[model samples]
Target: MPTVWVLGAGQLGAMLKQAAYPLALNVEPVEPDSEHLPNIAADDIVTVEREQWPDTPVTRHLSSQAGFINADIFGRIADRFHQKSMLDDLAISTAPWRVVNTDSTAQEMHAELGAHVLLKRREGGYDGKGQHWLHKDDGGAIPADWLGTGIAEQKIPFDEELSLVGARDKDGNKVFYPLTLNLHVNGILMASISPLSRVAHLQSQAEAMLGKIMDSTGYVGVMAMECFRVGDALMVNELAPRVHNSGHWTQAGACVSQFEMHLRAVSGLPLKAPDVRGQSVMINVIGVERNIGWLKIPATQCYWYGKDVRPGRKLGHINLNHPQKSVVQTALSELHTLLPQNYDQVFAWVKQELERA
Candidate 1:
C-alpha cells in the first residue's frame, strides 16, 4: 500500500495520522518548511491539509509528483477569483461579486455590488483575517494593498449558515454525510451540528450542488462546501478542497469519519455513505484553558490539539452524540456548566437551536 504524505502538519494532519493508524496504513504529516524531504516513492500519495503552500523546493518537488491527488484543482480553488468564476460558469448560486483591480474605485464597487460590500484577499486568509467591510455610509475605501488582489462581494443577508462535507474517489464514487448547521463567532467557527431532522429537506439539494462541483473538476478526496441559507435556497459561500472543521462531528457521530474517508478515497478503497447514529454537536475549544472536566458529560469526546494556548486560537474541539435529541441536549447542558462563563451565550444559542431542531 502507498504511504499517504500530508502537507501542512496542523490539527487536521494530526487527526489524519490518528485515523490512519487503525487502518494499518502509513501516514506522515510533514511540516511545510522543513528542510528534510520524505522519499517520494513511486506509489506514495501526496495531499494537502490546507489549500495553499509557500513556494519552496520541497513543495515544488512533492506537488510535482504523479501521486499528488487533485494537484490541478487546488490552485483554481485557492484563488477566490478563479473559484467564484468556476461557480459562475457552472451556474451555481453565489453572492454577486467582481474582481477589484488596482485602479478600481469604491464608488463603482458599491454601485455594482451594493452599498455594503466585503473585500477578501484572493489567497490566504482565515478566521476573519484579511477581510475588510466597506459600508456605503462610511464612504468605505479599499486598502491600497487589497486593491488588485481582492474580490468584492455583496454582503449577503443570510438566514443561517450550513455546510456539506463529502468525498469522491478516483473512480468518481461519492459519499456524503448529512448537511451540518454551523455558527461563526466573529468569523471563527464556534459550533456545528449534524443530521438535523429539521433541515432534512435540504440534503438532496446540497448533495446535487456539491456533486456537480466534484464531477466538473474531477476532484478526488474530501471536499467541503460552505453556504448561506436564505429561505429555502442556498448560496455558495466558499469551498474547502480538504476536510473541514464543520465535519469534526463525524469523528464521533459517524461510522466512517471524514479522515478515514479521505484516506479511503486517496488510497483507492471502496466508498460508501457513512452511518450517522444520531444527533451530534461539535463545539470548538478556542482560546480556552484545557479542562478534563469536559469529559464528564455523557456521550462526549474531546480532542486536544496539543498546542500552546492563545487568544482566538483553536486549541481543540469536543463532540457529543446520542440517539435521542434530549440526551444530546442534556449533555450539552452539562457541558455548559463545565465550560467557562464565556460560553454562556454560545450554549444559549446552541440550546435554542436544539429546541428548534
Candidate 2:
C-alpha cells in the first residue's frame, strides 16, 4: 500500500480521501494543528491546500518520507503579478496587468491599466473574499490586514471566463481535463459547463502555461488556470495550484475525475485522459438550505459537503447531466424554476419579473 500524508483536513482533502479509496491509494490527512501523524513517506506527503501550510510549525514535522506538494509556491504562483511575470518570461499573452503596493502605487498602476482594478492579497483568498474593486474616485478602503501581502491588477472586460484543470505526474508527464465554461454570481462561481466547444485550442494554451508554472515551482500534481475571453483572445486571469471549483462537473461527467487525477499525479501513477461523454452543467448550492426543498431536478446528482451551512456558504453542489446538449439547457431552465422566489419583492425586480414571467 502506498501511503501518502495530505495536509489540511478540509473539504478538498476529504474529497481526495474519498476518491483515493477506490484507487487503493492510502491517504492520511493531518490537520494543521494535529499532534500525531501516521507513518507516511516524506516524498509521499501532499497538500490539498498548500497556502495554509507554510509558516506553520507543522511543516518541520513533514518527515523525509514525505515531500510537500502544491508547495509553498502560493506566493510565487497564485498572485496575478507573479503569474503575469511568469507569462512574460514565457512569452504568453495575458490581460495587461500591474501590481500596486500602496495608494501612490495604485495611482501609477491605474494610469497604466485603468480606473477600475482587481485587488487581492498576494497569498490566500478564495470564495470571493479578500478581493475588492477599485474605482476612479474611491478613498483607499482596502484592508491592510489581508492574509499576507496584497496585489492589484487591471480587470479585463471580457466576454466570458474559462477554466482548465490538469495534472503533472512525478515524471513530469501531464494530462488535462476538458476545458470548462464558468458562470459567476456576485463574484462566486454559480455554474460550470464542461468540455467547452474550444477545448483543443484552450487545452494547448493551458498545457503550455501549466508546464511553465510547474517548472518554475518544481511542482507536481494538479493545477488549474482561469482565463478570460475577449473577442478571439484568451487572457489568463488567475491560477489555482490545485484541483478547482470549476472542474467539479467531472465527477459524473467524465471517466477520470480531477480528485483521482491529483491522486495519480502526487502518488506517481499513470494519468488518465478525460473521457467526456454527455454535456454537464454543475450548479453550486450557495446561501441555500435543504429545508428550502432544494429541488432535485431529473438527470441531476447532488454532492453535499459535510460542512456547516452559513450565509453565502457553499454547502454542496449538484451536477445536472444529459446525453445531448439540448437536455443541458433544459435542465438549467428547470432548475431555475425550482429555486425559491422572494416575496419581499413587491416593490422590487421580482414584481417586474412576475409581470414578465
Candidate 3:
C-alpha cells in the first residue's frame, strides 16, 4: 500500500487515518516532536493540517514551494497576500474585509454585512478559535501578531453558514463533497448536517468560486470554501485550504470522506467526488464537558481525541448518520443537549463574538 503522510497530531489527522486506511492506503502521521520523517518515502503522502510549518528539513522540502502548494495549507499556506489579492480580483463577493496593523485604525464597514465585525489571526484561526467579534465601539486591543497574521472582516448576518469541502488535482481536475450546513454555538461549531437545506444553485455557485480559487492559486488538495448566506446572496466568509471542521460530517455521510480525496489529489490520481448518500449530523464535543451519552445514539460515529480538556477546547466530534432524513435533527438535538453550551458568557476573559462594527 502506498503511504499517505499526514503532519499533525490533531483531530484532523486522526480522521484522515481512518478514511485512508479503508482504501488500502497507509496513513502516516507525524507529531510535532517527530524528527524521523525521512523514514517514509516522500512520494507516498500529503499533509493533514496546514497551520504551522514544520521545522524539519525533509518535511519542509516535501511541502509547499513557490511553483505549487500541495493539498494542505489551510491558513498555513504562504504567499497569503498574493492569494488574498487574487481572491479580491475574482470579484467574488466577500463579507466586509480589511487589513490592519496592531494599531491601525478601523475602517467604516458596509452596513449590510452586519452591525458587527469579526477579527481573525490570519494564521491559526479555525473551529471558532482565534476570532474576536467587535460590536459597536468595542474592538478589542489588537495584538502585535495581527500585523503579519491579521485579516479582519465584517460579521455577517448570515441566515446560516455553509462549507464546501472539495478537491483539485495537480492536473487541475476537480471534485466536490456536499455543502455542509453548519450551525455554531458561540463561535464553536455545534453541528453540521450534510445534504444542505439550500438548493443546487447555491452549491454550484460555491463550487464555481472554489474552482476559481484553486485555479488561481495552483493549489492541489482537499479544500473547503466557507461562506455566509444572507438571505439568497452567498458571500465569502473565508477560505480554508484543507479538510475543514464543517466537512467532518462526511465521515459517514458520503461515499468517500475528504481524507481519502486528499490522498488521491496529492498522489496525482483521479479525484472522486463525494455525494451525500445519506443525511449526516456531525456534533462536536467541546470544552470541559464530556458527553458520554453521545455514544448511545443509534448509528452514531464518535471520535474522541485523548486530549486533556479545558473550557472552549475541542476534544472530539460525533457523526450521526441516517438514510432516512427524519432522524438527523432528532439526533443532533439529543447530542447537543449532552455537550456544554458556550461557556464564554460565564468567563470574563472569553472574548465576545460581536464587538467593533
Candidate 4:
C-alpha cells in the first residue's frame, strides 16, 4: 500500500486521513510541534502543512535532491508577502499593499495608503489573528509588537467575499471547483455557499487567475484563493496552499472532495474532474460541543473534529447539500430558526445568497 506521511495532525490532516482510506493509502499524521520525527522509507510520500515545512526532513531531502523524490512547494507562495509580490509581479489584481519592515512605520504607511489600512504580520496570520486595523478616527499609532515584518493593505469596500478551491498536477492538468460565496464573522469564516449564482459570471475569470498562479508557482495539490468581489471586479485577497475551510462543502457536494484531490495530486495520481451535482452550504461550528443531532437532518453531513472546544476555534462544520436551491434555502432557514444565536451570521448570509439566487 502507498504510505503518505502527513506533517500536521490537525483537522485538515484528519480529513485527509479519512479521504485516503478509500484509495487504500496509509496516512501517518505527525503533530507539527512533536518532539520526535517518524522513521521514513525512500518510497514514503511526504506531505506537509505550510507552517511545518521548515522542520520536515523528508520535504527538505526531497526538494534538495530533485531526482530522489517529488515534493510539493509548501512555503514558497504561502507567505503573504511572497503571495502579494508574486501576484503584483504577474499583474494580477489585488488590493494595493506595501511591505512594512523594521524601518517602516504604521503611521507612514497609513499616510501613504490612507487612514483606513490593515496591518498584517507577513509570516503567520489567519482567521483575523496577527492583524491590526487602523482607522484615522482611532488614532494612527502603530502597535509596538507589530513592528517587525508586516504588510499594510488598503481595505476594499467589497460586496461579497469569494473563494475558489482547485488543484493542479505534475503534468499541468488542472481542475477547479465551483466558486463559493463566503461570510466572515469577526474575520473568521462563519459559512459558505458553493456554486454561487450571483457571481457565476466571474467564475471563468477566477479559474483563469488560479490557473495562472498554479502555472507560475508550479503548484501541485489543492490550493484555495480568497477574493473580494468589488462590483464587477474581483480583488485577490490571499492564498492558502492547502485544503481550506471554504472548500469543506466539497466533501458532500462534489464528486471528488478537496481532501481526496489533494492526495491524488501529491501522490501523482491522475487528477479527477471536480464535478458538482448540486448546491451546498457549509457552516463552521466554532467553539461548540459536537452535536451529532445535525446528522439526523436530511441531506446534512456533520464533520466534527475531535478537539477540545476553545473560543474562536473551529470545532467542526456542517455541510448541507440538495439538488434544489429552494430546498437548501428552506433547510437553512429552519436551521436558523432552531439555533438563532449560533446561526445568526450564517443564516443571514445564506438567506441573502438564496434571495440573490
- The runs of at least 3 residues in candidate 4 whose Cα sits more than 4 Å from the true structure, single-residue gaps closed, are 50-72, 337-342
Local distance difference test, each candidate: 0.93, 0.69, 0.67, 0.81
Best by lDDT: 1
By TM-score, the best candidate is 1
Estimate the overall C-alpha local distance difference test score of candidate 2.
Answer: 0.69
Residue by residue across 1-357, what tens digits does model 3's lDDT show?
557667666778777777776667777666756656445553455565655555676456445433234533454343334345567788878865676554554434324334576667656566667776656566444556565466667766677687888899889899888677767766777666667454446878889898988887778888888788877777877677777888887778887888778877876667776867677767677765566787897778888888998877778878888886656556655655565455333221111111100
Could you estimate the TM-score for every candidate? 0.99, 0.84, 0.81, 0.93
TM-score of 1: 0.99
Higher-ranked by TM-score: 1 or 2: 1
Across residues 135-197, which tens digit of lDDT does each residue of candidate 4 receive?
Answer: 977776777776666888997889889999999987889999999999998889999988877
RMSD of each: 0.9, 5.0, 6.0, 2.3
TM-score of model number 2: 0.84
- What is the overall TM-score of model 4 with all chains considered together? 0.93
Error of 3 at 137 (Å): 3.7
Indicate the residue-level lDDT of 167 in model 2.
81
Q: lDDT (0-100) at residue 5 of candidate 1?
A: 95
